[model samples]
Target: MKNIRNFCIIAHIDHGKSTLADRLLDYTGSVTDREKQDQLLDSMDLERERGITIKSHAIQMDFEYKGEKFILNLIDTPGHVDFSYEVSRSIAACEGALLIVDAAQSIQAQTISNLYLALENDLEIIPVLNKVDLPSANPEEVTDDIVELLGCAPEDVIHASGKTGFGVDNILAAVIERIPAPVGNVDEPLQALVFDSVYNPFRGVETYFRVINGEIKKGQKIKFVATDKSYFADEVGTLKLNQVIKQSVKAGDVGYLITGIKDAREVKVGDTITDSANPTINPIDGFEDVKPMVFAGIYPVDTDEFEELRSSMEKLQLNDASLVFAPESSAALGFGFRCGFLGMLHMEIIQERLEREFNMTVITTVPNVSYYAFTRKDPDTPVIVNNPTDLPDPSSIDRVEEPYIKATIITKSDFVGNVMSLCIEKRGQITNQTYLTPERVELSFDMPLAEIVFDFYDRLKTVSKGYASFDYTPIGMRTSKLVRVDILLNAQPVDALSALIHADNAVHIGKKMCEKLKELIPRQQFDIPIQAAIGAKIISRETTKALRKDVTAKCYGGDISRKRKLLEKQKKGKKRMRQVGNVEVPQEAFMAVLKLND
Candidate 1:
């Protein structure tokens, strides 16, 4: 245990965390020069393409320095704010963290958020300044920022360039000298925390765990403390580049345990694994279920493919326990599932993966955040609603509460005015603002999470010219005068097109939605009226004129009376068609109004 070092990397996105990991892997010979690619720990194709770590991955490295052998357990965590829960679990699993900050871009939004998390976890933090080789790098300024933020001496900060090999070896030496080794009671009954897991078709579920007490071996009967499900361990081993089977995984070690249980549902993150016969007296703390914050509906483009979509979702969920979904049907869209995700990015990644990996075509509705609705009769028992359709009638509701977030945005001084205006437009209240440096400023706001969950992030990136970074934490709930708006096609309500919006902008949004639907929906034989309404009152309307048959064509060169008679007959026919004809709305027509203000 004295030779074992457990530490993970935390950084802002695009801050060279993955690059540093790769450099360390190559330096230790854990990954051969020929075997490594950029962002080696980020194995998913989406992750590689986006250049971000979406999932947390762990590996064991054997390093020799000064004639001493050290086992370094490196856990690479996601840098995006949306995956903070995942980051928290990774931090909890380790005894120390390698906090990497880009020298050119010192202490962005996620940098502060993750630093606080590492401090809260009581992990020894090794501050490293990356990207020192860049022409714009300011190592000294960033070192000062770290010293001020972490209260560590300027000399204690390690400087390294991820792209180049400079200071790479020195950082490893620092980890050995600074980070503490894992300490646990080996004689205590087995108590391991399941931090992560992946599903295998042949082996059932492959679980990654950190042993806190005792040891686990092949053939031992194990039980998950949360589910109380027991399975005999078929194999237990450490991850060396890949799965390397071993007879036993001792306490203070990070390893994988294969139970030969084909069902992935039995194994979950935050669950405790203990010996069945000699169970531990208490389960380790800090295990939290990943509750999804964003909700969206996913339906098959072809109704016949509903079953196929279900199978794809089930298979996908086996690997991603954070994803939540249940069967739901829509009048406009057939049978489908309403899915919950950690955030909008997570929702998009899951949908993309389902299409790319499973070869499934799905139609995803606009994402929404959960809201609380209180009925006048049951004001104390506020109802939780994930969809606008589930909300109670406006008359029966006493008050509606929406989720709020405390957001921290780091941007250049030039764009502070623009960022402030954007936040105000999203109904944000400025709580505080601080100048991090002469050129960079951190703007803080208390805003509705519903507002930020939509196009706020994209708009921030656009208005700031990609120089801004953002991180937010939920700040409970606040009352809001929000109402649900419904879109109607020829007086027939389209339930799938309903959206919840603030009462102040309902008229403006209704007008734009009605007009946009006019452009998207094809004209029918009979005139169709596109309308937006709050309850029974129409707020906005647009007309799609019916096609004219040119009934007077046959009357050419004939008398004027003949032309008049033909026109009158055509008018009567059109009137009769309008009385009975139904609008045939295509799929794109429904998706056209997804983002009204985009």
Candidate 2:
């Protein structure tokens, strides 16, 4: 146990975390010459293409220092704020973290947030400055920033270039010297923390865990404490370039377990795995359930495939434990599942994964935040309204409360005014402001969660010219004057296109929704009236003109009265068609509501 070092890498997005990880693996001789590649720990194709780490990857490395062999378990984590939950889980399973900061960009919002997370867990922090090879890199300035942020000595900061593998040996030495090893009793009952899991079509679910006490052996009966389900361990192994099968994995080791449990729901991440016969007294602590910030509906393109979509979601949930969902039905979109996501990026990644991995094409409705609605009769009991259609009648409602978030933004001083105006336009109130440096500023704001759900992040990037980094944490709900805006096609309300908005911007948003839908919805044989309404009052309207067929073309050179009669007949036919014909709301129209500001 003294020679074992378990740690993870945490950083802001595009801060050279993965690149530094690759150099570490190469120096430790964990991979062969053929296996060498950039971003080696990022195994998913989507991750490589987007240059982001969507999942946390764990791998074992072996090294020898001064005639003594050492075992290193490195877990690479995502840098995006949406996957902070993943970082938390990874931190729980490790004793230390490598806090990587980009020398050129200095410290950003996500860096500060992730650093706080590590500090809360009491993990040993080793500050490393990466990307020193770039011409724009400012190692001296960033080193000073790290010293101020971490309160460490000047020489304590390590200068490294992931591209050139500089200072890789020093990082390894620091891990062995600074980070503590796992401390547990091998004689104690089995107590393992399951940090992650994945599904396999051929075998079953594979769970990756860290053994805190006792040991797990192949063919032994193991049980998940959360689910209280037991199964025989078909295989036990350590995570590497390829899974290394082992007869047994003892305490203070990181490994994988296959129980042949075909059902994905059986294995829960953050659950305790124990020996069925001699179980541990209690489960691990500090693993809190994920709080979803955005709610949206996901439905199959074909209604009959609802069951298939359900199964796909179950398998996906096994891989991504942060995703929460329940069955729901919509009048216009039929049966679907209301999914809770961390944020818009998290929601978009899940949708993309559903299409790429499962071969399931789906339609996602307008994303919204969960709201609390109270009625006059039941003023004390608040109804959770995740969808706009779930809101109670306007007459019976007492008041509605919406979730708020404490947003932290770090940007250059030049864009401070632009960023502040953008936040104020989103109904945000400035809470605090501080200068991290003469040219860099950190701004804090209290904003409604619903306000930033659509385009706030994108606009922030735009206004800051990609120099700003943003992070947010949910605050308690506050009462707000909100109203539900319903989109109607030919005077019939479409539940799928409806959204709850603040009363002040209801008319403006309603007008935008109407005009956007007019351009998206195709022209039919009869005119389709697109209306945005708040209850009986229509706030805005747009008309998609009908496709006309010239019935008078066949009667060319005929009497003017004859042409007029033919035109009147066509108008009457259009009116009759408008009454009986149903408007087919294209999929694009449902998504168009999100791009109202465009």
Candidate 3:
């Protein structure tokens, strides 16, 4: 335990956390030159292509410093705010973190976020200034920012170029010298924290954990404290960049525990693992499971693929336990799943993986955050409303509350005016704003998560000319005037098309949706009425005209009365058709309403 170092790299997105991991691997000779790949720890293809770590990954590396052999368990965490829960869990398992800052960009929102999380966990932070080899590199200035922000010594800060492998040796030496070793009793009962898990085709569910005390072996009986399920350890191994099966994993070590459990739900993340015969006294603190914040309905393009879609979602859930789903049926779109996500990016990555990885065509409804509706009958019990269709009548509700977030944006001072305007437009209330540096400012706002979840980030980037970075954490709910706007097709309400909207922009938003639907929906044999309404009151309406045909041309050579009779009969038939015809809204129309711009 004295020779082991358990630490993770923390940084903002595109700040070279992964690049540093690659360099460390190269310097330690963990993987030969022929076997090493760029961003070697990032397992997902989506991660490499997008240049961001979506999932937190851990690998055991062997490093030698001054003829002393040491074991380094390096956990690479995702920098996105959406995966902050996962980040926190990873930090909890480690004793120290390498806080990476861009030499040119200095400190950003996520960098501060990671710093706070590390502080909360009471982990030692090693500030490393990365990308010092770039033309715009300003290590001295960034080092100063770190010193002022974190109050660390000037000499304590390390200057390194993760891109060029400069100061790589110094960074490793600091880990061995400054970072404390794990302090766990080797003779105590087995106690491990399951931080992450993965589902395998042949091995079933594989649980990755950090051994806090005692030891675990292949034949030992282990129990999951949360699930209360006991099983014989089928396999035990340590992660050596890849899995290396071993008979036993000792205290203060990170390894996988395979119990032949096929269901990932049974062996959930954040659950504790202990010896079944002599279990640990208590589970580790801060083991709360992650809850979904935003929701959207996911439907298959073809009705026959509903079962296939369900199966694929189940398999995906085995890997992503945060993704919540249940059977949902839409009148216009058929059977689907109403899925919940940690945030918008998590929702998008899941959608992309489903379509690309599983080879499935699926349509997703507009994303919406959860709301709390206090009903007149049950005013004390606020009903959690995830779907717009679940909301009661406006007269029967006391008040509605939507989720709000404390959003922080760090950008150049030149774009503060533009950013303030955009935030105000999104119903953002400026809580605080201060200049972090002479040229860069930190803008804080208490705003609804719904607003930031939508195109707010893209707009901020555009207004700031890509100079701004954003981060947000939910700050509970706020009371507001919100209403459910229902889109009606041919006078029938579509459950899936309903949206909970703020009352101020309800009318304009409804009218815009009606217009976009009118353009996307195909013309039928009869006129299709597209209307947006709140309860029984219609706010906006648009009509798709019926296909015109020259039915009277066949009677062109006949008598006038014959043509008149034919026209009269056609008019009556049209009236009857309008009464009984059902509007067939194409799949594209629903998607158009989601992406429609006002």
Candidate 4:
């Protein structure tokens, strides 16, 4: 335990944290001679395809320094600001963090935010400037920035190119020399904090954590602090310290425990596992129960796969603690589940995983923000509405408030003015600004969470030419003029196409939404009018350009069977759609405009 070192790799998105993680595994001989992979920590297909780390991953490796064995617990956290909650949880499981900065780009908005989180937790931070092989690499400037921002000594910075394995040994050496050893009592009663967990088909639930202050072995009885439930430890599998071998783990060492637990709901993140005989104190703080902010209804294109979707979600919920769901009944969409997520990215990742991993195609409804309303005679009433049809009557409410966030954007100084104007146009108020470097600036604003949920970040990058970065934290909620916009296929309203938009932008946004829907829904058998309506008023309308050929001219006598088959197929397909007068609206037609700008 005296030689144990636990730390997380912190960096901005695309700053090469996963690349560096792969390099460290190689440096420590954790990678076998027969197997070599790129970005090994990004195990999910969606993560590799999207080029972003969505979840926190941990692995154990052993490093030899001066002929002495040192155990290194490498924890890789998501770099995006939306997943900061996951980052916080990962950071809590470690004793220190390696602050990885891009030498060519210097510090970013996420760099400051993650560094501040580490500082607040009093975790030891070792600054390292990566991508030193780039022609534009400026290690000296990046080192200075680190010193000025983190108050660390400039001489402590390590220059490395994770892609080429240059200066990586220096990173390992610094890890042993600079990072403090884990400190805790090993001989006391068993106590372990479950920082993370994964479900295995064979082994059941595997709960991983640091043994803070006691010795735990197979066959010992333990208890969880939060649930107060006790269970017998089936086995204490040999723990991995990166590539090193460990027969037994003591206090302050990282390890995993396998038990009779099969349900993920039983073992939770941030829960303390302690010996039944004698337990230690629960050092859980700075951790809050994760509540989902954005919600959407996920159903299948084929109703036959409904059971498959349910099972897949159950399996996914094992690894993702932020996902929440409850049975949903829709008059138009039929039975489905109301799924909750941390943010839009989190929601998308789950949907993609369902298709890629589980092989089930799904149709998702428009995402909506949870709202709270108060009347002149009543107090605030909490309501969760994803469909516009569920919106409360405007006259029955005295005030309505939407969640707001305090955001910080870092970008090149050349586009600062444009970013500021974009923020203002999105209902944002400037609070502060800072010159990060001669060519870089940080702008802070208070904006509605709904305003930035969809494509705000993408637009920010588009306007700034991919040089802009952002970070946001919830501030609270404020009253706003919110209106519900419904879409009618011909005249009857389609509940799935409803949205809550600010009153001021309704008309212009309604027009853009209708235009987008016209492009998404394929040209129907008959021309379909896509209209955006508020009550009896139609503000915008567009049509799917008329169908070229509805019926084949060669289906008459001998091909009567084939023609009957084709007509039967079309009838079954039309059963999945909603009809309003003469128009047949495809399911995608209703789901298309939800992500119009996305």
Candidate 5:
């Protein structure tokens, strides 16, 4: 255990965290000949599809230096700000971090943010300059920048091209030399911190943790500090912490536990796993109360597929304990769940997975920030609402508070004005600004979490010509004029199509919703009026033309069989839709309204 070095790779988005992780695995011979992928740490299909590290993945390796065996446990963390909390928790489990910086791109806002977090945790920092093989590589300049930024000696910098495998051996050596060995007493009772977890259909919940004290083994009875429940550990799984050998993981080690606990609700990520005999005096921190800022209702396209949707979400939650859900029933839309997530990115990931992994189509309402409001008469009491239909009487509302975030944008100086103007238009208040480099500036602002969530990231890149990088952290709540925008089909309200928006932007928001409805919802069997209304006044309206008749007028005896089959298919298709009076609306009608731009 003294030879083990546990570290995590931190960097901004596209700074090559996953690529560097792959290079480390390749250099240490951890990746087998048959299993070499470009970015191996991004194991999820969605991660690969999105080209982002949405989740933290860990792998172990063995490297030999000066005739001594060194074990390296590396965790790959998400670069996006939406998952910053996950990144923080990942850093909590590591003793060191490989701060990967693009030689050409220099340091980004997230680089500084994550670096500060790593420093706060007192983790040893090994600065690595990646992408040195690129044409714009400036190793010397970036090295100097890092030295000044991190206050580390220039000689300590590790220059490496993870893409070309250049200088990878030196990076590995630096890990062994610079990262301190795990320090703890093995004689103490077993205690481990559950930093991350994944759901395996075969093994149920596979929890990854760092053994903080004592020893853990297969068949040992363990107790969770959060749940106060005792369970027998079925087995302890070993990662490739050097060579492939089965051994009981003890204190100062990193590994996984596979208990036959199918219910993910029982085991949370940040829970303490300890020996039932003598729980450690300082138990691991219980799961942090991660509040889901974005609230959306998810429903299947076909009502019959509701069961499948629930099953998929349950399975997904087994791996992601951060997601929150509650069964919600709508008079017009049947049964669905009001799902809450950390932010928009989290919601998108879950939506994409359900469509791709479970082979089910789903409709999602527009993402909304939960609000707390009180009516004039009920000033002392507050109401929390996600759906507009649940909004308390406007007359009763005394004040409303919305969640806001402190956002930091790092971009080339050329985009500073554009970003400032864009943020100002979105109700953002400039807080602070700093020059990261002669050509780059870091701008901080207090913006509503809802403002920057949906397309702000892509818009930032577009306006800045892909030179802008950003990160954000929550900064509590603030007073705002938030209201519910109701969507009407024909003359009745469609609960699923309702959205919460700032009152000032309701008219513009309604127009956008109408446009998105045209793109998201298919034509109905009858002309459906998609109208956004405030109170009884309609702000925006568009009609979707009725779908053409599927059954032909003439049917021969032989063709009658085919016509019957066609009729049966049409009937089954109609079964997937809900009829509200004369209009035949698909589940997507509600979902399309959520994505106004799409």
Candidate 6:
């Protein structure tokens, strides 16, 4: 146990976390030369293509220091704010963390947020400055920033270049000397914290856990405390580049356990694993349930495949425990699930994964944040409104409280005005501002969660020329003047197009929605009137003109009575078609609502 070191890498996006992890792996001789690759721990193809880490991956490394062998368990975590929950879970399973910051970018919003998470867990922090070899790297300036932020000596900061493997040895030596090993007694009852799990089609679900007490042996009868389900361990192994079979994994170590449990729900992340004969008294603490920031409906393109989509989501949820969902049905989209995501990026990734991995074509409705609605009859109890169509009638609604978030944005001082303007336009109130350096500034704002759901991030990047880094945390619910806007087609309400928006912007947004729909919805035999309404009042309207047939052209040079008769006959046919014709909304129209700002 004294020679075991368990730690994770945490940083802001594109701060060389994965690259530094690769350096550590190579320095420890964990991978062969043939297996060497960039962002090696990022196993997902989507992660590699986008040059980002989406999943938190764990692997073990063996290092020899001064002729003494040491075991190192390194968990690589995603840097994006959307995956902050993943970082939190990873932090819970480790005793220490490597706080990597880009020398060029200094400290950004996500870096500060992730640092706070590590500090809250009481993990040992090791500051490292990465990418020092780049021409733009200012190691001295970043080192000072680290000293002020972490309150550590200037010399304690390790300057490293992941590209050239400069300070990799120093990092390894610091881990062994600074970070404490797992403290547990082997004689105690087995207690392992399940940090993560993945679904295997052939082997059932594979659970990765950190053993805090006692030891687990191959083929031991184990039980998950949360689910109270027992199963024989089919396999026990350590997570390496490949799984290394072990006869026993003792206390103060991280490993994998397979119980051949085919059902994904049987193995829950953050649950406790203990010996069935002598179970632990309590489950692990400090691990909280994930809070999703965005809510959106995900329905199958084909209605009949509802069951298949459900199964796919279950399997996907096993891999991504942060994803929360429940069965929901839409009037226009039919049977589907209302999924809660961490952010827009997380939502988009899930949608793409469903298509690529499960071959499930799905339609995602306009994403919105959960709101609390209080009705006149039930003023004390608030109704949770995740879908706009679920909102009660306007007359009955006493008050509506929307979720607000504390946004932290770090950017260059030159773009401060632009960033401030964008936030204010989104109904954001400036809370604080500080100049980290003469040229770098950090701005804080209190903004409604719904305001930033659409295009805030993209617009912020554009305004700041991609120099800004944004991170947010839900503050709480605040009462707001919000109205539900419903889009109607030919006097019929389309529930899927309804949205809950602030009353001040409702009219303008309604007009935009009506105009956008006009361009996307194709013309029919009869006029299709598109209306945006709030309660019983119509706020905006647009019409797609009918595709008229020239009945008079066919009766050229004929008598005026003959032409009139033909026109009347055409009008009657059109009226009949209008009564029976159903508007087939193209798939593009559902997606168009999301890009209304474009």
lDDT of 5 by residue, 24-45 (tens): 8888888787888877877788
Question: In model 4, which runs have C-alpha deviations exceeding 4 angstroms?
Answer: 238-248, 277-286, 303-308, 379-387, 522-527, 543-591, 594-598
Which pairs, if any, clash in model 4?
Answer: 60-241, 60-242, 61-241, 61-242, 61-243, 62-243
For model 2, what is the alpha-carbon lDDT of residue 552?
Answer: 79
TM-score for each prediction? 0.94, 0.99, 0.94, 0.89, 0.89, 0.98
| Better candidate by TM-score, 1 or 2 | 2
Who is ahead in lDDT, 2 or 5? 2
Q: What is the C-alpha lDDT of each candidate?
A: 0.87, 0.94, 0.87, 0.80, 0.81, 0.93
Ten-residue segment with the worst summed lDDT in candidate 2?
589-598
Off by over 4 Å in 1: 304-308, 547-556, 559-594
* Model 3 misplaced regions, further than 4 Å: 300-311, 327-329, 553-588
Candidate 1 lDDT (Cα, 0 to 1): 0.87
In candidate 3 the C-alpha lDDT for residue 54 amounts to 87
Which has the greatest TM-score?
2
Candidate 2 residue-wise lDDT, 399-506, digit = tens: 999999999999999999999999999999999999999989999999999999999999999999999999999889999999999999998999999999999999
Residue-level error in angstroms, candidate 2, position 75 = 0.6
Name the TM-score of candidate 4.
0.89
**Clash list (residue pairs), candidate 1:** 204-262
Q: After superposition, how far is residue 95 of candidate 4 from its true place, in Å?
A: 0.8
* Alpha-carbon runs more than 4 Å astray in model 5: 241-245, 304-308, 515-527, 544-582, 586-598
lDDT of 4 by residue, 399-425 (tens): 778889899999999999899999998
RMSD of each: 2.3, 1.0, 2.2, 5.3, 6.1, 1.2
